[model samples]
Target: MIEHIIEIAFYLSTALTLFILMLPSQYGPTPRGSSDSAAEPKTTVQVLVLGDIGRSPRMQYHALSIARGGGQVDIIGYHESDVHPDISSHPRIQVVALPPHPFCLQTSNRVIFLLLGPVKVLFQVFSLWWILAYRTKPVKWLLVQNPPSIPTLAIASLVCFFRQTKLVIDWHNFGYTILALKLGDNHPLVKISRWYEKAFCKSATAHLCVTNVMASVLKKDFKLESPILPLHDRPANHFQPIQDDQERKEFLLSLSETAPVRGLLKEGKAEVIVSSTSWSPDEDFSLLIDALCRYSEISNTSKPRLPHILAIITGKGPQREMYVERISSLQNNGKLRNVTIRTAWLSTVNYARLLASASLGVSLHTSSSGVDLPMKVVDMFGSGLPVVGWSRFKAWPELVTDGVNGRGFGSSGELVEELIDLFGNPAKLEKLRIGARESSSYRWDDEWTPVAGKLLGLV
Candidate 1:
């Protein structure tokens, strides 16, 4: 019944929008068919990211690419964090914050979650419609992020239908699979979520999936008529490897002054390992902690002493403080040694530098859909840093070439073995680093411009 009501609203919003467009120039905003003579020469493309704009790096990259191709873009999303200046400051790109989702979204209690879900969906529908109908100007091409499939996909499809716009969906993962994580896979909600994803996905004029595996599933199963482009995340120009040893030296000296990692720095003596996390449910930080504990044992009580490790975990999420407490307990109890674990929330500039300067990288992502690749690993590769990634998924092999660019581990014991083997054997570590460095050549524009850029009308 609620889904029916939302479907009705989609049509109603279209009718109301059409009415607004028919009004006189003085009475209402400019119509979809007409354009401002003084505005940007190229048609404005709208990128709708229902999630946090700052955190949605791939969508932001898409907007940036469009801008680079002499296109103006209206990036509509929640400005929850500081955006990279490249997009926010670009003359051709405009970031528009959506009407905020008005509900307690952080509640983990299933009962409270179930109770609040309907009201939240209702609010999202109205808020999204209000923005599309009255706030943003009409666009020719509208690109939206999936896994936020429910309201976003439905609403985007409706707006595009009425406005004569082409809908493009950038698939990161399946919304149904993610919902199944919270509500069991057998749950009715999970089943409905899957149905909704398939139904709305057909409305897309073009699809950009994170992996070829995802594209195959969408075509074979969903039977989408649109052009499916397997668009993997590649690092932007800013994420460059540190070529100058002196620059890395200065970067470490600067990071050592920061409170979180203060007194934790051993400079040249310590091997700096960087890991990024959202601290979300899919990521099991316990695996990382367990591996570190075993690594400490190998370093202290074993032969061929390993260098001290300074582990820097970056990014913010709900589970952050819990892991911080666990890390503190390990350190204070003397159970974790030769390893100093520190967490940070860094700016884009600092993060790129961190990736470039760090000796190695770690990934804890277990894709909810088991096919989506982790973008963090791509960033590490861009900076010529070899990664030790979670290999519990299909797409990891496509991104991390086991023995080439990086190594993948399925268990904590394996991870400990990997850490000890690589860190203890500098020659092996350097070889992997060399292989990862080759990936630095694969820039975003190099791949994007040839396919997605041309598809989006980029010359």
Candidate 2:
């Protein structure tokens, strides 16, 4: 399989090279990102993502930071959702949307992914190679996200190797670790996937990861000789606490007419909790559901009972419909009370606003690699909202810091217990909120410059 993949990539790259050489710049792939030709940034950077541009906020932030450093950025990815205006309207950044995936767009079935993965990679490899080779203006450096690294890593490495473009791979999580979640870690396919990651990762000129543990793993496990820097995810400028009472009320009223929103806007609301998920395999929403169920049971008879809670979940994914059905079942059978769970996908602006106004945030991500941290938790901290999340993973402590900005729980009962303790006591909740606000003071712009910007020679 590896041999065949290499053969295909080799031939396709050879064809692309010959075609590009035969055609002149005007006749070949058209010129782009040169609209303001007079005074363009001296350095051009390419940010690559093999998935939706809107969903991949970190890469978008990377582009924004590069632009602030006076570098032209060309973001290459799929145009599935509404990207933030900062990226779309930026004068120095240009988004190059790729053709949609041939298959595997809707389903999350592992069998279907296995059967059609290669074909999908073929399509992507062709399109991505064409873009990197000739479509956009020549870039001094290229940065790509891992996890969807099968074809992307190889393609970016080959392009950088030939074109002398510096390659920087930002590792959010391991691709093989995610594949291992679907297929057992010992599966032969999983073994091969790990090998693929280790092999192509060596091609990177520099590496940036989400956690220090991840950096250690890459150096010890992948035997990386390149510089590995851990750039922790921080919330952007848009996500901040709504300190003013009128601003908070106005934000709540601006939300669409939903049951959960209506419940929160009542004359005297107790509290509002927000949870965001991609509904992907990494997150165990069942844990959250079970926690809510336990809370409901305790709400009926337990002492120091909590107030009416509006738990709003925002984001879209495949498993959403199944969980929605389960929530409906609980509501119909007279099980759910004192709590309302609603799911909606909000635009970029609305999402930041919602995060800013919420009383608390929850993260249920069970990292497949156990070393990568959840960005949603970071976003919540940025919004000055406290969080409670699963605590089994090694990475959780680095972000959660029990009794500080947020708490961590190991089970549904523990989560419910945390909820009661915090919500029942306003003083404790306020303390954590204060901690989260302090956390928010450490903004992304301040964080990005010292690490990623310096690496790109932009700082």
Candidate 3:
């Protein structure tokens, strides 16, 4: 019996060794032409930002940045109706849309995701590998976006290993932390995801994080040694404020089907409060609804009645229908008064236009990972719209000051008070508008050019 146990242990050890050997190692063969190509003409670096292109604005930004810098970029992403025209029309960037992943696997149910996640990832890895290996140019570097980090990094690492290319992981949030939000911290799948995260993060050639806080978390939690660069998202030039009132009026008229907005436009007294959300579980839309309801209740008894409010909530996500039903019920019950809440899935140009025309912006995003800053707030600021945002994470203070470009609130009640005060006082709103405009000079091109150049060895 002892001899049989010893034999079993030996087989297990050997199997583990073989599995380790099969994985893409951190070390690999030297890149092509390292020894003999010193005299060869310089070729433009070919970069592929592989991820969901339809939803990821940062990926679009990265591809555009490289292309604008005279590098060739092939963006392998999934198709969505709202994908920006700028990406498809770019001379130096090529957009390849991958087929949609399985619908059942993308469901919000944590158990379903956990049970079938590996199978889904295996399919993704196979498709991505085929594209990377045979269908594309000899890529010098591949920048992958994380959160769905397991398969993205795992497959990218394998391709990089064989092709002798560098893998740069742009870390937005940890996939495990996001899983923990839905599945709890102690779930077995979450534990396994955490392990995969650490292993894959360590294997990457370099890491680009959205904020300094994210970079710090990676260092402290994962003990990553690869160079980490903080690459925050900045506004594109198209996000600027509308210069012509006529154009703004025309756009407003186009949405006349929404009665409150049309009435406000006719009266010229509409206090448009725009909020862009992913409609995900992380965003507490109830808080925004509660605040609006509270403000309406207070205004009913107060002198100098509030102006008509047209609250525009934008973005598409799985939880959207749930919120829409909730809001519809409230409106039907007359609990929410005097405010017209419109939910829209706007195209890129329309989204920018809406932000540009809005009087104020609100962000209800409480980060699933406490490190990454909200890109929606950045986009709002870009359009010169002052924001009132939730202050739950460390990165909030970096983006907003209480009375500066935006205000940050900790609770629904506090947000209501702030909004009431702002609506009652026009001068304070003007000050915030000025502050937002002043802070809007930080553009994507200026922020990403130097970093992309350095990372790709162009500068």
TM of each candidate vs. truth? 0.91, 0.91, 0.88
Model 2 lowest lDDT segment of ten: 23-32
Better of 1 and 3 by lDDT: 1
Candidate 2 structure quality by residue, lDDT tens digits, 257-368:
3445464466645567899999988898998888888887887786765776777899888799999999999988877787778888888878888888877899989899
List per-prediction Cα lDDT, in the order shown: 0.84, 0.84, 0.78
Q: Is candidate 2 or candidate 3 better by TM-score?
A: 2
lDDT of 3: 0.78
Segments of candidate 3 deviating more than 4 angstroms? 1-51, 243-250, 256-258
Stretches of model 2 off by over 4 angstroms after superposition:
1-38, 103-105, 257-265
For model 2, which pairs clash?
none
User: Model 1, range 1-459, lDDT digits (tens) per residue?
Assistant: 999999999999999998668532332223333365555535558888888899989889999999888777888888889898898789888888876766565476789899888888888887777777567777778899987887999988877777777889999999999888889899999999999999988988899998989989999989998899998889889898887877875787688424344354434556788989998888898999999998988799767678778788999887898999999999999977788888888899999999998888999898898889999999999999999989988777778888888998989999999999998899999898888889888998887887778777776
List CA RMSD, all candidates.
Answer: 4.2, 4.1, 4.1
lDDT for position 205 in model 2: 89
Model 3, 122-196: lDDT tens digits are 888777766766566566788888877767778787777776778888888888887787888898888989999
Q: Against the correct fold, how does model 1 do in TM-score? A: 0.91
